[model samples]
Target: MKGLKVADINKAAGLRLHRRGGEAPAKASQQQPAALSKPGAAATASKNKNKENAASAKPGNNSKAVRLPAVKAKPAVVDVPPAAAAVPATGNAADRCTESLKKKYSEVGDVDNESEDCRDCLLVSAYVKDIFTYLQQLEISAAAVRPDFLQSPSRLQITPRMRTILCDWLVQVHQRFTLLPESLYLTYHIIDAFMSSDAGASVKKSEFQLIGVSAMLLASKYEEIYPPNVADFVYITDQAFTAAEIRATEQRLLKQLNFFLGYPLPIHFLRRYSKVAAATPAVHEAAKYLAELARADYSAAHLPPSGLAAGAFCLARELLPSREGACGGSGWTDALEVFSGYSRQQLEPLVRQIAGLAVRAGDNAKYTAIRKKYSSSSGSMVSTWPELDGTGEALRSAAGLS
Candidate 1:
């Protein structure tokens, strides 16, 4: 399954922001309940009619929908043009997976499953569920850092505030390079995971920023198609550490963590949960903003990436005018409960915690990188949302972070 990309979400929200003048987000595309599709002359006629309607759609409409082949029919062969093959494009992973699921389980057609646009894409491998399960188990392994790792005896020099400063700086570096969101999240995870391991005990205060830069180097190598050259990373730091030092620190970080970099991120969880909840673009964008904010807070260490993602999503629905008409009447659904493994009761405190962080994000003077990053038009100026403009009971209780 494809995960939702930060860029895509931002672009989607940017469209709504400019077009709707920031009114409640227009409803996500929804599919209606339909009788079982059958293969026959009538079905064929109906399919042709739908095709004609789709063909006549206005510019920027999201579909160029094609008819699905009849069951057990011999498929026709088509010759692909060289240019079409060279220009690779497919829906994001979540969209493709949602499309696959929708075909198998059309009963939920009344909901916006987020798959309609990728109707022509191929389905993923059958073991994808097993992959998610394996990653979930990995989330608990020794590869992860403990909460309050800065207070541990092995790493005495680094402070929570120091880590916060480093992370905030890295967010700016990430945007300056226009790196993927996975790289940003993974870069910080590498730093924390390395710090937790005994090998990193020797790391000094002078080398702290070096460790951060190296972690980004390593993460970009893992996540980017064309990572920045070592020279670019070196220059980004004003050559404080030479390219050689960065390469050395990257090796140190990976060796300390036993080269484990595939730990799932909150963005991963948010994408899946958003579809399950039928969350609107606005709600999903809010969740994305909160999840990214979680990357910088030491307090967020208390929640696993999945829980952090789940919390952001749950709170977003509450904070925003929700998708009441989408699926299961708006709030947390039984389907979400089953898939996310989070109940309404379990999520309340977490929601408030993330909400507190999201609501007050712009107020913090010391660390404003994330807030500034989201305030731009590409982010749809999400940091300035009126929904987050108040201090409600949710923000009042157990005052905390995203």
Candidate 2:
């Protein structure tokens, strides 16, 4: 998985940009290094290929070439607060042990009894939320210092239909991972957020796929305790992308964001908050539902992924176990209440909407017809896993995305 090279992705993007700039084919070849001078290279030359396609397909006159402004890199520790300071933690050693025992006992009774996992899962959710809140505050400050750093487009420049198609494609790629729904959401948020600013025009639509892939790679490591290896990442895609290409793209994405890999996500914060509150099983379930829902929709992409996540946790607690009965529980609920503006009533509908989407997420046959149009090729650039068809089904059968 560590196989991707930064220079190659820069070269790839540079090559595409040069082609768009009308550099002659022969001259372009001369500019490339020996590594790309192979006889068959022309067949996969992204720059020239896009140039020809863009010329023949669209006759637009936007002669003013746009340069991507250099963005200031985020600090090594921008969004993360020292773990010691982020939360007023409760539960000394014994209480934690007790909770762990309870969860373990529940699990032994039935793995499918999600009610048991809720305690542990909510703990994980709280960590995700803490990180997210820290990230959100840091992201805001970072953007204030350098407005272009995290700016991006509100929507993909492509047609509305294309946007839907793009999301469908994302679902296919996500299937290959192991319990990385949060990672998928993070990847989507990063690309969508980064493109919101002027930096977007510098990137081509084809480049978007690579960005998504790289973000997923980074997110997997951050979220999953045991992430798939580079080979697994490549393997999961079923060879749609060569290991070399995926590796290269991963590096490029890192460079583009200046390696803000540690930026927090919402899942982290939610788990922590839930625990301190001693949330009931149902409230914890509702929080998980909100996080998953927030991840699947693009509109949710605009909010700092963490803020939306924290809000979800807050909302879930309010809705579940009856808000009136939750007062004496834990400090977690009180703390979350202060941070998230939403009340239980406000989030109920959104929660339902997300629940519906989660159920439908695995219903691939409905979107199969639309997805086929974009998945037309099996070249080194595109992933070709046949298992792509069963991803949604597998997700449904595996813990129901909660």
For TM-score, the strongest prediction is 1
- When summed lDDT is taken over every stretch of 10 residues in candidate 2, the lowest stretch is 378-387
Task: Give lDDT tens digits, candidate 2, residues 1-402.
Answer: 222333343333322221112334664445655575577777778778898867765647545556899999976432212222222112232322233334433333322123454477653533443554466556444421121323333434433334345555555555423235577666665565555545555666555555556667677666666654566555444444677887887776666667665555566556555644556655555565557555545545444544455556654443333532655432133234333323334344444444344445335455442234224532111112221222434223322344
Candidate 1: tens digits of C-alpha lDDT, residues 1-402? 011133433343332221112356789999997756674868789999999887778677877769898788788542221111111112222422333333333433322224553353343323333444555555665376677777776557878887888888788777767778889988888888777767666777888888888998899889876677677766666657798898888887777777878888878878877766667787888778878887678877646677688777876676665433444333566556545445567677777677667666656777788888878987777777766533544444424532
Using Cα atoms with residue i matched to residue i, what is each candidate's TM-score against the true structure? 0.67, 0.46
Model 1 CA lDDT for position 119: 50
Q: Tell how far residue 334 is off in model 2, in angstroms.
A: 4.7
